[model samples]
Target chain A: MKIMHCPLNGPRNISEFAYGGQVEVMPDPHQCSDKDWASYVFYEKNAIGVVKEWWQHSPSSYWFIAERHNASDDILRTYDPSELFSERVDFTTGENEP
Target chain B: MTTGLVSPKRCADSHGDRHNDGLKLHDLSLATRSGVRGVKASEWLIAQSLHQELKTHELQPPELQPNTLVELPGSRLLMALSTREFWLLEPETEAQASPIPSGHCAPGVWPLYNQNSHAWLVLSGEPRAEMMAKLCGVDLRIEAFPVGTVAQTQMALASVVIAHHLWRDEAVFSLFVDQSLADFAWEALQDAMEEFNSVQ
Candidate 1:
């Protein structure tokens, strides 16, 4: 079984995680045209180079960013969402209630 | 307490139900479990003075010690499930029925949820380590996962929060599965153990 190193939980089996979609900033709704908004929602560059994307550790429901090469499927690096922000785990999905 | 699925009515001790080699499987449903969950929850627990109170008396709940399963003086078991979460097992003073006694919890620190989230189970016996090997990938051997070690991991196809605890000098593995999948997980566990019993 392939293992992915979780920044917080150490190396874990790939089965323990889910691939979150490509990480791209949402276009500014007020400034972007409707056509641009539509493209942003449905498109992915799918560039052959490395791109940052979200991956969730399902057991803990913790979200983290993974930089991977699209063409090679190589994970260049993985880290917690907090590394790039002040918030800890992304609470956006709200599946886990406090 | 005399309530819920794990209530006194449906709960039972090991019931002398030992596997072929004297392995004990007990219903932990009656044990009061509270989720001290969310990221940075240990800090919130510290702020509430529960950690201090436990520490002041030198009663180290499993999380505080480097060991995998240390029991407290009051038998309050703390299983730090993740970097940001923990589940307290056998809580001596469970107050989830009432408010958190104002001034105990501050805004945004980390909120505490009642007992609606998890279903509890315990795997106790001499062969538990061998049995656990068949169920999940994370190493449960004493040297690797130790006593105080806790984690949110996949077990028998369920996302479970597991904490190793010691009861009566015997190794005990406490499982906290999401309430929704509790029954399925428990059933899977039984089947997993059945094969071992038949073989032995």
Candidate 2:
């Protein structure tokens, strides 16, 4: 098998993961209702492209938000979920919760 | 310390009957002796010579993908592409003779426990894959999981290691998990399996 060096974890088996869909689309809180928000949270399109998704490192307790091409299954980039959340909300806040 | 063969006190026939009927409880006894001895956990790294009498079959390891099985010569096999790691098996009698390897054998550096405490459910028949898909999240397609492959994942919320032992025109999959979860896992499997009349 061809081993591709993943920028985040280096050479790891691609099989140990589930491709979660593309990134970049926000929930659009301005136009979306609570029902829309809830649906967005639970439902998945399982789409293919430049999408953002959550990856659970089962063996390790690490979670990453990654950007990748859906068709070719090539990961473009990845970042710690905490880092992404920190950018949008206060480190300690009402909704964010410590 | 006792000398010679240390046999645990065997319960009466009444207890044996209860155990056979799935009424009695059995503990995970590492002291349960098998005819063949096990290699020490410390000796995992040292590759011992193959037995002179037994035939050895070397198979090319499958590519790094999900639902892959690697068959060994005898009825034994290894499920290598599982999330947890490898699942080892052998014939019921010879299983005791198989040596347990130690050290970092598979990816993720997960330790391979002897797992003698677990019970196994060996399922066969035409609709085995269909029954599995009801409880597991992984795809159970024959194309996705060719014969001689294994999958280590959760089934019915319990951690399980499964392997497909291929035969001519038929496939058999073995399910191994903690003995504590045996009843729960077995019930869930039976519930799923009951949907198809073909499963008996």
Candidate 3:
């Protein structure tokens, strides 16, 4: 059986979890242009390598992040959102465009 | 105060089904239950001296380990759902008393949620785990899920909060589920238990 190690619940059947999509650091709407804001809402990268994304354990209703490779769909690891940051901070995107 | 909210329609009493005593399902409709959640929940407990053992000065206070329940020698049971979350189950014999302050509120602090609308069910018997295997993905074997272990997980395609306790040799599992989906959950659980009943 496929298992996803919940930071709280330990290794559990992946069925107990729901994919919560990618965790993107939102840009400040006041600083971004209409086009950037629209793209942020509409566009999602179909990138192949490792991706950090949100996942929820339905039983506990706890949300956390899982690092996985897109091509393989193999989850590298899962950790609580608190482990990364207690509060939100911007992820540094390579592009200067906010 | 919240406990006298509503009288539950006991599914087992209504169904009147005959089952082997070795494995039986019961509707715990009469159980008085409540939810405690918020950032300062643990703090409030400590301040009130409800559960001072949970006091932590760490930046990331550890969660109350899963599958555990808090009880004094003769006090009510408190299931720790997480670090700042709990489910308090009151006895049916006693009038529901507010454990926290009447207006247990503060600006952006520990807020209380009354969970009186949910349905409580109990599945107890020697074959309880065998029956649960059909519905849940979690391991319910006694060694893995010892008494006092609580888990909030999926059961019978519905969200459920479960606590394992033993009544002598019989394994008792308590379930709390959303009231809106209680009937659906009950039917699904009954189906899970039927095959086991037949086999035994």
DockQ of predictions, in order shown: 0.45, 0.05, 0.54
Quality of model 3 by C-alpha lDDT: 0.69
Query: Candidate 2 on B6-121: residue-level lDDT in tens?
Result: 12331111123332311111211222211112222112212222222122343332232334555545444444432323334443322233455554433323344444556666
TM-score of chain A of each: 0.75, 0.56, 0.77
- What's the lDDT for residue B181 in model 1? 83
Clashing residue pairs for model 3: B67-B148, B67-B149, B67-B150
Q: Provide TM-scores for the models.
A: 0.77, 0.45, 0.79
Model 2 chain A: worst 10 consecutive residues (lDDT sum): A1-10
What's the true lDDT of residue A83 in model 1?
Answer: 71
Model 3 per-residue lDDT at B46 = 53
Worst 10 residues of 2 chain B by lDDT: B33-42
Per-residue lDDT, model 2, residue B88, is: 46
Pitting candidate 1 against candidate 2, the one with the higher DockQ is 1
> Deviation in angstroms for B128 in model 1?
1.2
Residue B111, candidate 2: alpha-carbon lDDT: 48
lDDT for each residue of candidate 3 in B1-200, tens digit (9 for 90 to 100): 23342344443421235645656666655555665577676555555545443333221123456447754323356677777676666634343455554554553244434344577777777667877888888888888888879877789768888888653345588888888888888888877766764553
- DockQ-derived CAPRI band for the predicted complex in model 3: medium
